[model samples]
Target: MPRSRSWLPLLALLLLPLLSAIATAADDTRPNILFLFTDDQAPWALNASGYDQAHTPVLDSLVKEGVYLTNAFTVTPVCSPSRASLMTSQYGSELGITDWLHPQREPEAGLKPGTLTWAKVLQDAGYRTGLVGKWHLGLTDAMHPTKFGYDYFMGFRGGGNSPKNPTLEKNGETKKFEGLTPDILTNHALEFLNVDSDKPFCLSVHYRAPHAAWLPVADEDWAPFKDLDPMIPNPDYPKLNVDRVKKMTREYLASVASVDRNVGRILNLLKEKNLDDNTIVIFSSDHGYNMGHNGIWHKGNGHWVLTENPPFTKNIPKGQRPNMYDNSIRVPTMIRWPGVVQAGSTIDKTVSNLDWFPTLLEMAGAELPADAKIHGNSFVPLLKGDDAKWDNDFYAEYSTKHQSHTHMRMIRTSEWKLIRDFLNEGRDELYHLTEDPAEANNLIASNSPEVQSVIKQLDAKILANMQAINDPVLKEAKAKSSN
Candidate 1:
């Protein structure tokens, strides 16, 4: 061979290793993910979404700096099922976790040990995973966060506890904190962020706020809404007692305000550490809440006070039905990714908590297992301002047959929403959302052909979704109908 040919071979050998190193570094430059989850936060609770009653200055600022999803929803309105769906990217029916995981009754009900979560996937892809707040999925050793993927878990294992001076569990050890729950959790999350690690990190900071027993928030947090009579849904609904509604609203908003303050603290830490640019921050809730909306308080199977007295009475009648109303399922969702996701962008298309699984995995450059059956489509294209085709419909299921609520399934589109109570002898609810966004009117009794056609269409969609998820309730309902 000639000298020129030998020189060419040597240059190729040297450049090949350098090129491989560059490729490896580029692939490892995945963004760190910070997910901020709240409990019982309604879609309209944020000031950015037009609820001025809420003093969420930090979240509002995030809305301006991120993509606000106007129609985001949870697969189930309850905590465990919704959180399970978020982690597994599947419906609650598919996971057989239709109700909140209770410690005494269903201690073993949780994501299976071998289940694939976005966190686990990211961890497999070389990301550090940590959870610093509420983990309602399970309490058993086999169902623990560490059993699944998280390298660090420091939070409560049950549904919820008092926001003040609560006990927390960390790596098989339990300890009590002296400060507020949100503040303490935020401090732990900040500590997780400060952990010296070269690998990218994924931290989930779930807060128990604005849930039931909504008292004892710091006085400063309650000061903003204490004197203000926050707005209630469907004020004209005769069954609703406006006084009780106003009081609950004040307490709920105060809790939300506390959460907002802590959110600001987290955001400030990211900026202080100069991690804002490379961090993908998300803010959302487990599900929505109803503060006297459609004559209900709390979530699934919500009750209302019948009389204006010191001792309140629940107005539930025999065979009473709970509902999956918009106020109970729709949640405020926003995402901030510095250069990839456009700032101040709002997506009106319907999206679900399930979508987060696939979106985060895609963003982290993680591969989905071949056997993994994910029900959510990745919305990363939408975040990138691409002309992506998106789903316009949503499906939600809530099964509390063992609780006070009846089993409910819902299908909603842009213009219409249909809610079916499988166990209730009462009529289903059909609303034309364009004409009535508040969902105050039910057109289920209408005999008009157009109304019937829409109901039929939505009912078919619900059945199809049920079949897709192998819903046992649907099978039972079908058996009953056949008989």
Candidate 2:
């Protein structure tokens, strides 16, 4: 009888191709990404964050189904810079985008061509990337989303848009739409999701709601808070007029309600399509906002005038001095990746928009360019419930030639925060959050040894961060001050 033919070699060759096919299928099963970004939203704006009056049922449910970050912040408090940091995963000072782009003045200031964004990385890795919302990073043809990494771009290019009868850009063509801007944007997002594609997708849906110019929302959304009297923050500053505060609160809450309802629409769509299990959904804001907190009506310049008469004066001198209060810099952030991130969990450690780039890239299993200079470490380990290696401190900076707010840097720990005005404006602030969570008391002028010690520690940290990022303001300001 002939020796038993060894089938091992033939079987090995046949199984190799089958194994390769299985690997390809596994790669194709990578999770889809849905990033939901909001404008000027604070951490406390949602009912999930303990705001009893906020009608944000959708967000509240999301909080229950995801990891809520109580200590999330933007690298800068302004719109363009904060959004830039999110896109680049670097500080605004490093990118030279320190203020909101003024079309006439800073027309040339934006993300330049060849800048590697997380979206570009994922796109290059075979994911179908789309951005359907505000693209405040830039407006020039070369700076458009298509030039960056987006296969589909449909939204406003500027910082904001009118809620009603707004005009939008569809891959560079301006189109007019009639309806609330959030709802309209959601419809466009759903349209993008419905596209015929077999590859994994990344969609960024940024909503321009609850930002500013708070107007009456749809009658249904406005009805819940119409007669409600929300509790407004009362810092040690002069007391605000109660009636005026209530009116602003009502309108703001109404706008938030509209945003929440629209968020529900997106969530429902994901469930209906059975994509909830493999889709990673993230919600956050560019930065925080203040309605009547700390005697401030809005963000940045924290000042408002209270009339002593029945009919309040409309022409209150707007305060031009910007502030670094938590209400302005700390934003609400959450992420939901089914079976990955623990449901109903909360992370108290400090995290910023700067970490988004590395985190997303890690989730996509893509490699960063060897020469890429990224300042943010991936927080994916924290999402997987490993906090032992997390950083508990955060640093931020804001610089502007805009006369209203100028060069400033801040360093914050869990219990203390120190802000220094690099221009020697003598408008510095320090707060011990453990004792004063409202930031009502400023300790910059304190002579207490404990306060001084904390300041010394934080000052060194701020300088280290500035040096690491090659902060131009710090370098220039030090030179000017020394000279």
Candidate 3:
């Protein structure tokens, strides 16, 4: 027995390699997700991501290495509500955040406090989560991203970080932590990726680039850094839009180009860590903006209006109007997941922000609560090269503070689009998108029987989502029209 003590040590050494082999197997089985989001970015900017406008060799490499979702949209235009809706897989009103209610309004008082969220669901499914960059969902301490299930938070809580924005970069890095704010966010994101933890992670890196203060050079707009500037204002832009004097279309483009460079930064990080295959990179915006596209500077909703900015703000006549337009509602979205998602794949089908929360779950094989109601259908099927039928439509409503009086609703199908202004005695219009991507014609009053039939189908589709918003807005609006 005394001689056997030497043999016991030999057996312990033999079992250590077996344990190490099991750990390696586990690492190979789990996938990681990197959510690359930018503020006020457009789908067109991605060409720089790798399609070649600015030679975003890294972003292009990601696209070449992964899949990109071609058509994607957000639930609302304003900041907080859009993010809230994106997290919960529901529209603003359904989630009880019917306005840009964070910095400006603060979330509604008596409502469901903690419905399931994207971060919460992923954490529950065992993912290590980190939220860096713009975290404007809720300014309240209780609503911080950490409360929503993120393990680490390195972003500003208020809306944005433009030098013009007061709350920009108070804490993340400056003496507290100083540097270019967007660059700070990107650098932190790289640090998060560099983390070599065993738990799978989700880095919600929301870059504040291309949103505003459209500065190109990192240090210029803030002083001691002017060479970082990239864009100038478009002087004759309004003549191009026909409504208001243009402000800064050229500057807007420059802002976008700057964001593209940051996008390349994120893509490059993924590769540097050798995590490209397991990470899912997505790019989109809160909603559309105006860079003289429709004779406006920025937007919160006004169609058919004579000016871009607010009336008193920019001196426009009372009751100047806006018709529901594509530039505002239709935006670009890209998704890239190597091997799992098709490379350079563009479904061109209409989808909404409500779908993002669930799609992430599907990617990680996580479970959604059976009782939870998710308005967005998973495009995971689309990304996987499966032709599973999707609703192929979107219903968007933004009767919020900026255009609250408008009470607008929109429904778009594969080939047709309809818009109804509920407040205007239910005035309705339809357009053949194939013939008019700009929605220049209102086919509602047309006597053509063929157009009426198409209108009817669009109406049915609208009714389905109206039921989602609440059957009454549509029922009451439609009833008002009939009378």
Q: Please give, for residues 1-483, the per-residue lDDT of candidate 1 as tens digits.
A: 534566888899999999987866785578989999999999788888788778999999889999999989998988999999999998888888888888888877887788888888888888899998888888888888887789999999899798899899876899888988888888898999988776888999999887766777878898998799778767877656888888888888999999999999889999999889999999999999888777777776566643532332143354233668788888889999998888999988888999998999988988888888899999898888888888789988988744554668899999999988787655489999999888888999999999999999999999899888888988889888999
Per-candidate Cα lDDT values, in order, are: 0.85, 0.84, 0.65
Worst 10 residues of 1 by lDDT: 307-316
What TM-score against the true fold does each predicted structure earn?
0.92, 0.92, 0.80
Model 2 pairs in collision: none
Q: Write the per-residue lDDT of candidate 2 for residues 211-255, one digit (tens) a residue.
A: 777674788899988788778777334656667777888888888
Instruction: Write candidate 3's Cα lDDT for 1-483 as tens digits.
Output: 355477777888998898877875675567888877667665544454342333234455555655655556665766666777778887776766655553544543212447678788888877889988776766666766777888888877777565232234323342344555566777777887888877788888877766777754443222322223322223344334332222244455555555556777777777778887777777667766544444444544543323344343222234334444565654556677766776765676677888888888888778888888888887888878787878877777766454445556778776888877666553567889889775657788888898988888787877778885674566777688799
Misplaced by over 4 Å in model 1 are 1-24, 308-321
Model 3 residue 53 lDDT score: 32
What overall lDDT, based on C-alpha atoms, would model 2 receive against the true structure? 0.84
> Could you tell me which 10 consecutive residues in candidate 3 have the lowest summed lDDT?
224-233
Which parts of model 2 have CA positions greater than 4 angstroms off? 1-24, 235-237, 305-318
Better of 2 and 3 by TM-score: 2
User: What does candidate 1 score on TM?
Assistant: 0.92
Pairs in clash, predicted candidate 1: none
Model 1 residue 81 lDDT? 93
Q: What lDDT does model 1 reach?
A: 0.85
